[model samples]
Target: MAADVDWDPYYGDRRTVLALVGLNLDAAAITARLTGCLLTDDELADGFAAWPGWADPFAGFFPLTDDINPA
Candidate 1:
């Protein structure tokens, strides 16, 4: 059997959340990676607005499905 604990406390630390998602980068590197996408202000707004409906909001700006494994 599995146990259930309140997740509210863990949500307060972004690093913990990102680590849970498999992204080990710190906040600054994450910010740089995201900002380096070069999305325009309007595009950024559109991405946010389309988020709930779109399965992947960043599909327009990034490749979410491409295999990145090196040979």
Candidate 2:
């Protein structure tokens, strides 16, 4: 079972959220646009976790990256 979270309150600001979406784009073309921008590792990867879940609300599966190796 999953917890019901009031996520809207946490992301109330639209512009900031949009900017973050822009930052999360993985295209090579925008590499220069975000050049030198300071973002923590989590900031970079949070989109991956939040995206597919939101895009497919019923799906619980997510794609993991190589950086997170299992013990």
Candidate 3:
């Protein structure tokens, strides 16, 4: 599963990020977060209906690094 994730942008490195996410999670917690408040199978169906393979609903948490301020 980690192989499928490319989290370097936020994590700086996939291994480091995977470790961070892993520290806060176990199988049960991962299941709960995905099922309880964050995203459920049904919700994912609807969320992904707009686009096929976009991952991470919270990706909008960070603004594009390339975005510039016009002053």
Candidate 4:
């Protein structure tokens, strides 16, 4: 049996939360759990809106490279 860890205490620390998400250990689960805990619904909506191509899952399939030559 795994020990349950209460994540509420860590919610107030943005860096710790972000670092946890960045670890990608269980990103989807972590994101879902932290969704409304750190930010309000409106703030979350605004963040989603501000992220480019966030609405489209296929957006990252063909990543943009910075090596393009403009002639």
TM-score of 4: 0.24
Task: Assess candidate 1 and give its TM-score to the true structure.
Answer: 0.23
RMSD (Å) per prediction:
9.4, 15.4, 12.2, 11.8
lDDT of 4 at 7: 31
lDDT of 4 by residue, 1-71 (tens): 12235334645433342564333267676567655345556656687556564455344544487765545
Q: Candidate 2, TM-score vs. the true structure?
A: 0.17
In candidate 1, position 63 carries an lDDT of: 50
Q: Runs in model 2 with CA error above 4 Å?
A: 1-7, 16-32, 35-41, 44-71
Tens-place lDDT digits, model 1, residues 25-45: 467766676556555767666
**Residues forming the 10-long window of minimal summed lDDT in candidate 4:** 1-10
Task: Let me know the TM-score candidate 3 reaches against the reference structure.
Answer: 0.20
Residue runs of model 3 more than 4 Å from their true location after superposition? 1-17, 21-38, 49-71
lDDT of 3 by residue, 11-50 (tens): 3544422333434347775555544445455665686565
Q: How far is candidate 2 from the true structure (C-alpha RMSD, Å)?
A: 15.4
Which scores better on lDDT, 1 or 2?
1
Q: How displaced is residue 56 in candidate 1, in Å?
A: 17
Regions of model 1 farther than 4 Å from truth:
1-24, 41-71
Clashing pairs in 2: none
lDDT of 2 by residue, 1-71 (tens): 12233335655432332343533566553454445343466765787565544444224434455765567
Ranking of models by TM-score: 4, 1, 3, 2
Error of 3 at 61 (Å): 10
